[model samples]
Target: MYLNSIQLQDPNHYMQIAQSSLLPMLKGALYYTLPLTLITFSIGLILALLTALAKISSIKPLQWIARFYVSIIRGTPLLVQLYIIFYGLPSIHITINPFPAAVIGFSLNVGAYASEIIRAAILSIPKGQWEAGYSINMNYSQILRRIILPQAVRVSIPPLSNTFISLVKDTSLASLILVTEMFRKAQEIAATTYEFLLLYSEAALIYWIICFILSIIQQKLEGRFDKYVSH
Candidate 1:
């Protein structure tokens, strides 16, 4: 009976801790995690589009440069990339703040992986479509902008959405560089409270909730795009 009462009290204590920490952690997520994901993914998507175009372009140098960039980014672990930007660059007297460093690392990583998806989507468009565009006296740019990219975007949606979701989780890595994101908030709270399991679980729940919401949004977007494509 005494042990049971102690267990009940412990839960109440943890509950209070959760209630207290939830707001600050949520603030961290809102202020840092979401912003990092949006900024990096937006920048990365542009880089990916350019890289994809370069990969398919006739210019040998452009293809080579794009391939090299993709190889370097894909070959290295993202954590190492973050370390290089945040830690190693200081050795060369080039320093970036924690947020910018995370942005560069995550953007480069996303660009490499997403470029492949974009390139494949672009390539998957039937050659006949391009021929039709040319038959209509459309220039290469017109063909791509009007015929190719629209189709490619439809095909790329799922994979790119997955990448965006992954980026949200990856933003937790920013904590290692002292970026004070959601997971960092949990860590700080845990350190003070010495409640590692409870705090970390709460943080994990928050991340899962964010990802779950994103997954639903992805499904909705995919359905909307599919409907558009079918028409």
Candidate 2:
């Protein structure tokens, strides 16, 4: 009888509920998720470019270190990576809040993956371009900066943007460490209202909307870059 006895006393309380917490939760989610995606992606991009250069360098130590970093980061799951940042840090007495931990972890993981993409793009450049740079008496760094990297960046943009888009969705994993992003907000709302379906569905809808906008941005960026590549 208790199960059947459950009912909305006001019958329209959810309309009231929507006004009170739901709107704020959506706003909180956006504030965290967008910044998380942008900051992590920017950090990861700079790191990837540097690491990819090291990977291709003739310097043995740099090549080895680059290989090692990529192997270790790629071998682990990002969830475990986050746990190491949030939980493992305290064992050595180093501590950070959930947001910074998530940023560091996500950026490092994305950096490792993006390094491979960058390395591949750079390598795809024709050998003749480097030869032409050498013929012009250009040093390795000059050749890379002037002739190779710009083309590689154009090739890399599509994949890098896609990686960042994936990172946006991944930010929800921050909830495990108590970062109050979208999924965490949904869980909180569900707990308070016992309307798990409605609350979570609304949260999912918000995420989809954000991702849809990012998709539009991605399409425009790809189109812009594609114009240069088209024969």
Candidate 3:
């Protein structure tokens, strides 16, 4: 009878914790996690485009600089990058808030990785496309802006979308730096309730649901883009 009673109470306890924690966790995701991903991805995409252009440029110095940047970022673990920005920087008397530090870390990491994707997309455009643009008396800038980028954007969409989804998951790392994202909220609740498994599971479910919705949106966007390209 005692064992059965304990078993009966366990479900109720977990349910109560879930009911109480869900709203605060959702608010954390909405207010912090989503915004962090969106802002960092936007900044990262711009940096990636510029870095890709630099890498492909004829100027040796520009290519060297871009290559060095990409190499360093790709070589290091992202958690170390976050730690250096948030914690190590204080040793040099440079202190950044948790949110900005997260933004900077994520943006730089994304830029290095995404630059390669963007570069590859640009290169995938046939040499004939450039020639055709030239045949029409289009200058290099005009050709790139009007002809090359449009096709590159199309080719790059799928990879970039995947990167965006990954970033959404990666924002959980921000919690370590004291950013009160969903996972952080989960940690807080778990710490108090001693329901680590339940709260963390709840957080994971929320993340999965968010990612699932994003995946659906990604598929729709891909289909729309494919139709446009086909037409």
Candidate 4:
């Protein structure tokens, strides 16, 4: 039954089946793909900012803790991390629903990676800027908020945007955790129709198109930022 008699008789029928299946898969992307990316990226950005600040803090304990956190997250495979959160957490009487578990796992992973990008951006600023703030009798917090971070954000935009583009792809991993994302829908369809390659390739194509559009937006943002910096 894997080979439909009709499709076998006329191979062009395979194209028809592929086209028919594509719309539903696209709808799956609209419902789950964008929402997952937006929520995960939003929460992840906050965590990344806090973690980056802790990494750069003068307090030794904070620096050590942040380093430990980033190392643990970055060293492990993301799938293993998802399993630890979703499947392992129940052992400790910490039970969370699957959606939240996926979000938490993805956010933590993104935080670790994005924190490094932000920290590097912060470091790239001239040391003289910090000294000037101190010379003006401004505190570290004031200098960071008013002087350092503002400039660093402009520099961070390109890398941070790339991180987000990557996050959009990573959300497919959520399907393994039972989040019903686009890839999950494709798997379900493939199981029923026994057309794994076609459905999976369609899913990949959709992901590619989504990322391509995001890359365009990223270029526009970079152009505007470049103009602003040049001014």
- TM-scores, all candidates, are 0.95, 0.90, 0.96, 0.92
**lDDT winner, 2 or 4:** 4
**Best lDDT among the predictions, by candidate number:** 3
Pairs that clash in candidate 4:
none
Candidate 3 clashing pairs?
A: none
Candidate 4: worst-modelled 10 consecutive residues by lDDT: 1-10
| lDDT value, residue 95 of candidate 3 | 100
lDDT, candidate 1, 4-40, per-residue tens: 6764446789889999999999999999999999999
The local distance difference test score of each candidate is 0.96, 0.87, 0.97, 0.89
**Clash count, one per candidate:** 0, 0, 0, 0
lDDT tens digits, residue span 1-231, model 3? 777676444777889999999999999999999999999999999999999999999999999999999999999999999999999999999999999999999999999999999999999999999999999999999999999999999999999999999999999999999999999999999999998988999999999999999999999999999999999
Q: What is the per-residue lDDT of model 4 for residues 64-86, given as tens digits with 9 covering 90 to 100?
A: 99999999999999999999999
Q: Rank the candidates by TM-score, best first.
A: 3, 1, 4, 2
Query: What lDDT would candidate 4 get against the real structure?
Result: 0.89
- Tell how far residue 50 is off in model 4, in angstroms: 1.0
Q: Between prediction 2 and prediction 3, which has the larger TM-score?
A: 3
197, model 4: CA deviation in Å?
Answer: 0.7
